[model samples]
Every structure is written in structure tokens, then in C-alpha cells.
Target: MTGVNIGILSIQGDVAENVSATRMAMDELGIEGVVSEVKNPEQISDLDGLVIPGGESTVIGTLSLVSGSLKKIKEKIASGMPVLGTCAGMILLSKKAKDRVVGEMEQPLLDHLDVKIERNAFGRQKDSFEADLSLEKIGISKFRGVFIRAPSVIDIGKDVEVLSRFNEKIVAIKQGNVIGTSFHPELTADLAVHKYFVTLVQKKN
Candidate 1:
């Protein structure tokens, strides 16, 4: 079996950890593939899937736009490229992003996922917490999710499905081939999330 080629957006934040988790997941699944940091849009090609890691959303988005990667990302997503966004990545994918303390910031977004998000919805870094996510709707139950300065899904379009939740708030969601979460799955030893994302990538491939 030809392994899936997964690329982690290396623009900023948790890139190395994501890449490691993705590789580990693939190994556990006995899938042959490579996971590496992708800094340019040109690397978008031949990638079975892409991961937008946790980071400063505004900075990553602005840098992507400035570096001409925003359009490429949009194009890939529009063409049905499977993507998994976590943490600040959620803000990049969201069509609407608001601040929990403030309200909105001037940040360029890929605008692929149809949802409204609130940055730092969980408060400060000290408010970072872990919870057993209810992702049973997607055949996953009790996923240990780590949320750090995460964003919350306030509103989503009808096409979006709630994959997981915590404290009555939407944390994990799926829309078509795109999967987004408010937590950092890579930070945990559990590889289920990455494994699931790889499955999505395989299906799309």
C-alpha cells in the first residue's frame, strides 16, 4: 500500500509536534507515508492531507497571505483536499472569528470552514484544561483533548457536524473532508485523532 503523504503547515506553532504525531499515527496504523513540515504552497502538491497546527492564528494567517500561501490553501481546500485544523488553526479555517475578550481582529483567513469562532474562549493559558471529549457521533469516544488558549466553535453551518463537545461547547467539528478541533491532539500520547485524520486523507485520495 502506498503510504499517505501528510503535510503539516510549518508557518508557525506546534509544527514539529504535529509532524511527529502524524508520523507516529501512520506508523501505528501500519500505513506507509511521510510527514514533514511544509512551508511553501508548492509542497501542497502530492500531499494526501494537510494539517494546520496550533499557533497564533492572526500571525499565521497574515504571514500566509503575505507569503502568497493563503490563496493556495483556499484552492486546495476548494478542490477537496482533506485538512485537519487544531487550536489556532481553527481560527484560520473559520469563516468568522471573534475574540472572547474583545471581538474581532483584522486577520486574513482561509475561510474554508463555515463556522463562527471565538479566540481564547477558554481564557488564559492558565485556563488550559484537559477533558474527555465526546466524539462518539464520529465513532470516537472519550478522546483526551488538551486545550490551550483554544478557540471555541460558536456557530456552524448546517453542513457541519458536531464530532465532539465539552462543557456544552462545540470543540470538534467536521465539514466534508475538513476536520477541526479546539484542542491539541498532538500534545497527548493518544494517536486516535491523527489516525482518524489519516483515514479521511486516505478516503479522499
Candidate 2:
């Protein structure tokens, strides 16, 4: 296959780790790809797939909007660009997000995924932890999921496919070309999720 260009939204979060993980994933899958950090809107045009890593949703959304990249990202996603959104990235991709104990949060979002997420559904930052996730569709039976101030999908649209659950809460889901996870896949050595995402990009190309 030709070299697939994968972009990681670098407005904030674990950008370098995602880049490394993605590159490793491509290599592990015997695929050709270049992983790059995307900080400008123009870069979205050359991307075969995008990853929004775990970070502060408000900060990521605000910076992307300020840099004029948010609109471009939405356009690309609308045009079938595959995206893997983790943690805060999942929040940014959701149609709605609210505080589990407080109420709704007024953060800027991509609003492409038709899921209602509960911000900090797992717990606060201090409560961050890792657990084994069973994502059968992606062919993983016990993938380690690292959650840090993660959010949970409280509601999902008809088109959404629930990939994994923890404590009966939706932790991972897929909607068309978009995949959202409440945990950070890059934080672990297993690259199953990243490999799956790279395959999505490969298929799209």
C-alpha cells in the first residue's frame, strides 16, 4: 500500500505518544504511513485519518477553534475521514456532554458523533486507573484501557455500535468512520486500537 498520512490533532494532549503509537501500529501491521502532528487547518486536507488524543476538551476545542482548524476537521470528518478520539477527544467528538454530578458543560465540540457523554463519569483525575476492556468487534478480548478523568457514553444513536463496556457503562463506541474511546490506547503497549484505526485509514484510501 502507499504511504497513508495520519494526523494527530496537536492542539493539546498526548500528541507525541499517539504519533509514536500510530507509527508503531502501522509498522506492526506491515502498512506504510506517516504520522504527523496537525496544528493548522490546511494540514487536514492531506490526512487519510486523524486522532484526537486525550486532553482537556475545553482547551483543545478552544485552541482548534482559534486556529481555524476545527471547521476544517469537521469538514474532513463529514467527508468520511476516519478518526479515533480518546478521552477528552471523545468528549469533543460527541453530540453532547454533561457533568455526571454537576450538570451540562458548555465546551466547544465537534458534535459529529451521535452520543451523549457524561464528563468525568469514571471519576476525577486523582481516580485515574487502568482496566481490561473486551472489544470483540476489533478482535480484542482483554485490551488494557487507561482512563484518566474519562467520560462515558450515557446515550448512543441508532448508528452507533458499542464496542466495549466497563461497569456497565459504555466506554468505547464506533459510529461510521468515527471511533471514540473513554480510555487512552496510546498509554498501553498493545496497539490493537491504533492498528484498527490505521486499517480504517487504509481502507478509506
Candidate 3:
């Protein structure tokens, strides 16, 4: 894992937290790597893996698009750059997104991940809550998932693997090396999910 470069899309959302979590995960795994904030296309191209943190999907997408980072991210992911998309980041990674209340959303998206997402599937910010999740795919069974205005995967491609669910709704999913979660694993104390993603980066690069 030496010299592996992992970047957190830092246009918005949990930039600092994701950076810290990824660094801690790398340390915990004894993997030598660089984790930093990435906002432009040049920085994105340098990443072996990426973390799109939880935040307003539209805002993040728009900001990235302004600097042409959106297209670069899609290209990287398409080229097998492992990415971890949490909460709104998950929605942005999907092929399509429909807001439960507003129906369709006209927002910029990476649209490389093969899934249809329902925005705000868990209600609004007021409905935010935390729960114990069983994420056996990532090796931790008793993971505490933090959800905040989370989106769910209502439809997925055949190759997509369901990692976890909440109230029978799809919450966490993995399509190849790309992982999308409706909850915020970076917001939790446990670093299992981040560690798992780091290992994937290690293997890929």
C-alpha cells in the first residue's frame, strides 16, 4: 500500500472528517498512503481511490462541475478507481436520482455507478437517526450506521451486491470496487468500512 493516493472530494460535506477517517484507516491497516482533499480535475486524476463524503448532493455536484471535476471523477471511477460514496455522495454516484417528494432532480452526477437512487428516502434532516448495522461484507458485523437525510438504492444492476439494509430498504451496496452507502460511516467511531475501502485501494493500485 506504499505510495497509494486516496483523495476525499472536498467541494463540500465532511471533507475534514473524511480526510481524518481515511488517514486513521490507513494507519490502522499499516498501509502507507496519502489522503488529502481533492477539488479539481488534476487532483482527482492523481487518486488511486476517492471518498465522496456526505453532504448536499446538488451543491457538491455543481461545485465540482464548475471546475470540470465531475467528468474527471466519472472517468476515474469508470477506469476502476475505487470510490466510497456516503449519503448524498451515494446519490451523486448513481445513474439516476429521484427525490421522493419532488420526483425528479435535475442535478449534475457522476452517473457511472449502475443504480437508481431515491433521494431523501429516509425522510428529511429532522428524521436523521443512528442504528446498529450488520455490514458483514466489509468484515464488521456490528457497525453503527449514521444516517442523515439518507438516500436509498431502489433499483440496482445485477452485479451490485447489497451490503446492508435498513427497514428493508437498500442502504449499502457495492458495484465492483465502488461502494455506495446511504449512511455516513465516516461519521461513526468505527473505521472498519474505511479500512475495508483502503484495502481495496491497496489491491487495486
- Give lDDT per model, in order: 0.88, 0.92, 0.91
Residue lDDT tens for model 1, 1-205: 3777899999999999999999888888887878888877788765789999999998889898988888888898988989999998888998999999898777899887889998999899999998888689777777899999889999989999989878878999999999999999999998888999987887777
**Pairs clashing in candidate 1?**
3-32
Alpha-carbon RMSD of each model: 1.3, 1.2, 1.2
- Model 2: per-residue Cα lDDT over 70-187, one tens digit each: 8898999999999999999999999999997889888889989999999999778799888888999889888999999889999999999999999889999999999999999999
Instruction: Let me know the TM-score candidate 2 reaches against the reference structure.
Output: 0.97
Alpha-carbon lDDT of model 1 = 0.88
In candidate 2 the C-alpha lDDT for residue 129 amounts to 89
TM-score of each: 0.96, 0.97, 0.97
The TM-score, computed over Cα atoms with residue i paired to residue i, of candidate 3 is: 0.97
Worst 10 residues of 3 by lDDT: 134-143
Off by over 4 Å in 2: none
